[model samples]
Target: MEIVNFTPVPALIGGALIGLSAAFLLWSQGRIAGISGIVGGLTKPVRGDLAWRAVFLIGLVLGGVLYRVLGFGVGVDHIQPVVSPTLLVLAGLLVGVGATIGAGCTSGHGICGLARRSPRSLVATLSFMGSGLVTVFVVRQLMGVGA
Candidate 1:
């Protein structure tokens, strides 16, 4: 697939959206905007909570669709990570496991946690980022694990 360059504008906008969503979820529903929890809730959800969770997720997907429908005005087509397919999959699995063990993903722990001044989530966010940095240092610098 073709890759696009990374620009600060899109990243900042996306981050703002995430922060907004997390804030809205907490204010409106008293819930954390952790993606995994939302997906997990689908398996066996409490009566009233299910609808909102589904709505939140649907809105997320629909936002992308709306962006595309609006002609994707941005110059960047897509941002692609520099990693091999196997390593990418491995990284994704490790991130999923880490998020599960930490009880939340980056958006949940970093943005939401910081907003709420949650010490545990803050620590989890730092640890998660540190691990990622160390992993990249080891794989790319030491082991030469990818191209």
Candidate 2:
């Protein structure tokens, strides 16, 4: 098996930026920077509350656009989706269900919740990471995908 190169600097910078964003949201707006919570709130809007969520989601989309425009992750393998679109959609639905069941998404549990030392977040984050590892193992080793 070919080992993947790990770029610590970029990963560290990205993680730091995410933490900063979460911290800024909490510090400034007294809110958790959880995508599912934000977007779910959008589905059932309340007066005087939908604007920030819309702005946050829009910023997320624009960030991806800016990243693509800057040609980040251009030629490196493993960046592109390996699964079929149907499977991708199914996986997304499952993730949505999982996030709902778990009461938060990865950002909520992994970053903000952990920073606040929440026990629920600890369990949620561990389960999230463990499931991810299992999924990759099944896809790559058991299924011989992208091998």
Can you give the lDDT of residue 30 in candidate 1?
Answer: 88
Report the alpha-carbon TM-score of model 2 versus the true structure: 0.87
Please tell me which predicted candidate would have the highest lDDT against the true structure.
2
For each candidate, the alpha-carbon lDDT, in order, equals: 0.80, 0.89
Residue by residue across 1-147, what tens digits does model 1's lDDT show?
556776789799988988888887888888988887786677667787688778878998898878878898363365577787887898788877777778887778788777889999889889989987998789888988653
Write the residue-wise lDDT of candidate 2 on 1-147 in tens digits: 676887899999989989999999999999999888888788778989999999999999887788778886474434778888988998999988898889789899889899999999999999999999998899889999777
Clash list (residue pairs), candidate 2: none
In candidate 2 the C-alpha lDDT for residue 73 amounts to 47
Model 1: residues with Cα > 4 Å off, grouped in runs: 1-6, 43-48, 73-85
Error of 2 at 124 (Å): 0.3
List all candidate RMSDs to the true structure: 4.4, 2.4
Residue 122, model 1: Cα distance from true site in angstroms: 1.1
Worst 10 residues of 1 by lDDT: 73-82
Q: Model 1: what TM-score?
A: 0.77
